[model samples]
Target chain A: MPKASSGLLSRSLAVYFKDLRLELRTKSGLNAIMMFGVTTLAVVSFALGQSGLSPKVLSALFWIIMFFSAMSGLAQTFIREEETGTSLILNLTAEPNSIYIGKLLFNLTLLITMTTIITPMFFVFTDASTDNILPFLVVLGLGVFGLVAATTLVAAIISKASVKGALFAVVSFPILMVLLMVLVGATEKIFDNESLSAVSSELQFLIAYVVVMTTISLLLFKFVWRE
Target chain B: MWYKLVLFVLMSIMIYFSFALPAPQQQIGESSRIFYYHIPQAWICVIAFAMSMFYSIMYLRKKEIKYDDKAAIAAKLGFIFCVLATVTGAMFAKVTWGMYWNWDPRQTSIFILLLIYGAYFALRGAIEVEEKKAALSAVYSIFAFVTVPFLIFIVPRMVPSLHPNDSIISEDLKFNIEGAISLVFFSALALFTVVYIWLFNIGVRVQLLMRKQLEEEDF
Candidate 1:
């Protein structure tokens, strides 16, 4: 049993690394997401035209960019597999659980890398400030995980559809709505210089969202993956 | 036939009493009458979504076409009721809040509900293969239902809003319903649920028959 479990872990990691290598080699998914994020930030910053926005508006804008950027790129994880006809080889090589975990890890890496690039640019462009930097980072981390967990399975589901792009956003938006709302709320508080303790409920909710969404996605992925 | 007649009479009585009864509260006055319709529609909507989720799970477990049919019917009915609830709630809000739409927590939750179920139909429409449609939609249905608790319960409490969470009970959580209002409210709830079940049965039968006809034509 121990050996079997280890094999599963190794296989999952292999799937993750394979996707990572593909992403790094092609850079298509990463490039698309980064360009979308940066372009949106540029457009938004240009539109505001030096007028300072409130924390509420700024927080909303930041997550909106993140959400749309995610929508633009995350589906590529599975859609690429389908488009390239690699999914059949993947199915033959690994279990659905491992494939899902691997794809999930790849998405997590992609999104984190995207945010790392976009976050500073977001603050610089919008002049958004948060006093509680640690809490803000915590929010961003959990929000990214929650977003990926909720949408990874959805990416798989939509990859099978004819109209993949629009369907991906329509399907994912409602699922991510809960996560986005909590992130915006917590970030707004942080921007207002609220203490970590003040946004604890939002923090807890984000943690719960990630855990619940990840678990549910793991359970449901097999159904989407098999056929 | 007998039950349908009974349902018709009960609904008529409920509607008449809802208006005839005194205002549930003095301040909201007659506008409060919308509650009789609004709450029941919202309740049926939630119940129908739950039914859809239940059937979806059964379909996933049993791999039966009948369960998928039932689930789809329940979702279609749920979506209609969801829209009805939103419209009626908006009407009530307009009467009381002096606007057609307020981003009140309850309003926001219902709006998200509409989006969630709307997405469910979009998912069903996207898949071409029948089994794939059944399987994928069933999975998505369960996935969407999981977020509903957060939408309905947690989101409202997180934000301070004008929604009257304590309208029926005070802060201390006391049960306070006038005798006449409770009668109308409970009856409305029961009758609306029956109406929902009746519509759901009709929908499922129609769906199964349509599918059968399609199969025969193919044969």
Candidate 2:
């Protein structure tokens, strides 16, 4: 059992690194995501123009940018494989679980990288302030994890469909609505100068959302991947 | 045919009682008359979605085309009922809350339900192969249903909302509704379930026939 499990982990890591190398070399997914994120941020900041937005609106705007950025790039993980005809090779080499894990890890890396860059830019451009920095980070971590976990399986599903672009966001937005709602709530509270404990329920919901989403995605990914 | 006749008679009586029997609610007055129609539409919407999920699971387990047909038909009916619920609820909100759309938790949840199934139909449309479409949509159906509990029950209660909490059932687990209101409300709920079942059966049969016709044409 241990040997089999270790094999799974190693194979998954192999898939992850393969994706990372491809991403680094081609830079299509990262470039699209970052360019979209930065451009949207510029347009939003330019449009709003020192209006002194409320915390609720600012928190919502932050996650909206993240959401659209994810919609822009995350599907590239599987779509690339399908488009380039590499999925057949990957399917032969690794188990569905391993491929799912690898792609999930790859998407996580892309999303975290995008978040790290876009977040500070978001704060600077909008002049958004959160009194509780530690809690804000925690919320951001959980929120991003939940977002990627939920979208990864969806990316796989949409890759097989004939129509790809807007379909991904249309299908994913409803599933991720619960995650976005909780993230916005937690971030809004933090921006309102409330302590972490005040938003504990929202944090707990975020944790629960991530756990539930990842579990189902892992369980369901094989069905999507196999066919 | 007899059951349909009985349904017609029962529905007429129910509609009549909903309007003619109960006294106008104290606060919202006659606007509360929408409760019978609105709540039943919402209840049946959830029921149809649950049925869709059940059939989706069945399709995945048995790999049967019939289950896929049933699942898709149930979703189509559910989407229709969901729209009915939303429109009816919006009218109720307009009368009571002085607005057409409040973004209340219930309202938001139902709206998301609409979008979820809208995406379901879109996904079906995007796939041309029969088995793949069936399998993929069944998988998507199950995934969407897994989020319904969170969307309907948990998220709505998480925030303070203008939606009434104790209108039907109280904290003490007793029915807050009295006499005629309770009678018509429960009757409407039961009747709507039957109505959904009737529609679902017809839809599945029609879908199966259409597929059979298409297959014959292909040959």
Candidate 3:
């Protein structure tokens, strides 16, 4: 058995590759998430029939897509670990801190990838475009950073929960509310061709939220992960 | 017992002086009276959460059952304070903002606080084994406490607030007086702290009593 942590990046990369390989082989969590994303986008687009899909509304719609998709993905991140009973084995064999950081990094990657795939779909389905794509991506990326950090932390807490689904949302949604606001504000700016600095307040908040959430989660993860 | 006596006295002074304090310089004149309970409730909610986190750390580090009990009690009390804060805040909002509910950061965060702690209790109720319940709830409590400030304070402040961001504390304290009213607020804070400790001790004792009864039944 190969030791996972060659270093932080390699270790996280290793876990990411392992999860990706397994997910690819099984075609389960990721597939479910992607299908869910597509159905969600389609349903939302059809639901808004002829409302003219204004840029502001498109921005909000984009975030709602990401939010629901992230929750569906994260809820299973640990559920799979638990199903295989790999959580205990991992706990015994590896450093708990490394496991947390590793999972967080992987979840971040999944969110970024999912958002990457969905952003274009969101663009085509709605009336968004490539003109402000880079700035829009930047805002989406920052918001996802906050989302992954907060969700992974909450997921760890809710993972052991007996009543899982409702409980996870209860623990996560409130904190995510801030990130959602910033993401929406930034998206609006991107669509309007405004400077990223125009939504600088929201940007600063997105950064602070990611920092605070990650710091606290790292400190508290060990306690929550303990049997 | 002594803590309770002191608490009662402090609470009496607080209630008595609340009726006597001068109205604050603002639009929400008579409604400002709600702060006499509202502010203290919110502050204690924070305090209870902090205490829960501190005990959580101690329990995990020491693997002590007593620390677990302490954490559990503090969390229960924290939940009570969170509810009080929300209720008092709703009353104040109705009087000042002309509505019982608004999406003000303060209001939103407190509501979230209630949900988080509500989930905390639900987690505790779901687990059946005594030791597992203690360990898991301790872990969740610590995480939830860590989550609260971010959810309740930092996030809300990041966006604009309709509620005035004016200072409740001193802008300049050099000449500030230890007036009768300040005394009342401080006293209320002191009283709440006492009530918290007493309630916590009682909770631990009750848990112990229940455990012994269960043991007797097992025998």
Candidate 4:
């Protein structure tokens, strides 16, 4: 074992690798999330006939997929440990910040994979047009950061609960509603071919949301992490 | 206690003012009366949530089991008041705007607040382990409150809202309170705060008793 003073990054990375290895072997979280994301996209695209979706509605539809898919899977990081009776082992082995960061990174990877597939498929299926590609990705990046930053700790909180799955959405939607609304607005601006400056305000809000949420999660993780 | 009588009399006076006072002419029509009930319900709802958050912080800081009881009860009462606000606000919307669920910024924000607190209770109900439930939920309560400002203030400003700006903060709301209505409004505010505290005290007592009973059961 490494010295306890190996620093937060190394400790966190140790946790990250542990979970990543387990995840690769099990593939449960990724499969559930991807299945939900793609299935939602397929059903919605077929129902809406893949056209006539204004930028506004298309933006909303895209996020609704991301949101529900996230709802389906993001809690699994903490949930998996609890279900496998490894929560206390993780708690004892890792610093709380390390565990939190590790889980957050795991969630980030899942979200990135899901969004990468869903965004292109959504654009093709819904024919959602974007006038500015770069700003859209920036907003998407900020959006995912803020969403997982808030939910990672919340996922830890709900992991102990009996009603884990539904409770995650109930808790998360309120916190993420502000970010989602901003993303939709930013997406609308991007579709209108607005310049980066036009998207700056939404980007700013997303940045603020991410910072505030991350600070709170870092501060409170110890309380939620241990029994 | 004398405080209970004070609440009762003050509540009666507020009701009288809500109905007996002349309605505003320009916008609300007879529906202006709803404000007397609606605003206080929403304000108390906010007060209850704030109180819950405060106690949750206290629980974390002190690690006192008592703080958990107080926090849980405050959140429960707050959630109830929030529902009352949404329902009354909807009724007011139906009368004034001719629709029940308009997704006005104020309405949407409160709905979000409702969901947040609902999750708090759902969380409490889901965890059977006593100490773990208290610790985790207290942390969750504090974390969840970070969004309250954005949902209530920033989001409202960003969206084009059909709900008027609160009369207390901005004159930009559909109708401004002046003269007699102002007196009634302030009185209702005072009455509601007192009533909220009174109910909160009862709630803490009841939660403590329930906790004691559960402990005895375990023995």
DockQ of every candidate: 0.78, 0.74, 0.41, 0.73
Reference interface contacts recovered per candidate? 0.72, 0.60, 0.42, 0.81
> What is the per-residue lDDT of model 4 for residues A98-127, given as tens digits with 9 covering 90 to 100?
888888998999899888988898889887
Error (Å) of candidate 2 at residue A186 is: 1.2
Query: Superposing all C-alpha atoms, what RMSD in Å does each candidate have to the true structure?
Result: 2.3, 2.5, 3.4, 2.3
Give me the TM-scores for chain A across all models, comma-separated. Answer: 0.96, 0.96, 0.91, 0.97
Error of 3 at B43 (Å): 1.4
Instruction: Give the docking tier of candidate 2.
Output: medium
TM-score of chain B of each: 0.92, 0.90, 0.84, 0.90
Which portions of model 2 show Cα errors greater than 4 Å? A1-6, B161-175
| Model 4 chain B worst lDDT window (10 residues) | B165-174
Which number leads on DockQ? 1
How do the residues B161-210 of candidate 1 rate in per-residue lDDT, one tens digit apiece? 33554353131123245698888889999999999999988998898889
For lDDT, the strongest prediction is 1
Candidate 3 error regions (>4 Å):
A4-8, A53-57, A128-131, B1-10, B20-27, B147-157, B161-178
What does DockQ come to for candidate 2?
0.74
lDDT of each: 0.87, 0.87, 0.72, 0.84
Taking candidate 2, what TM-score does its chain B reach relative to the real chain B? 0.90
Candidate 3: tens digits of C-alpha lDDT, residues A18-38? 666777788676776677788
Which segments of candidate 1 are over 4 A away from where they belong? A1-5, B161-175
TM-score on B-chain, cand. 3: 0.84
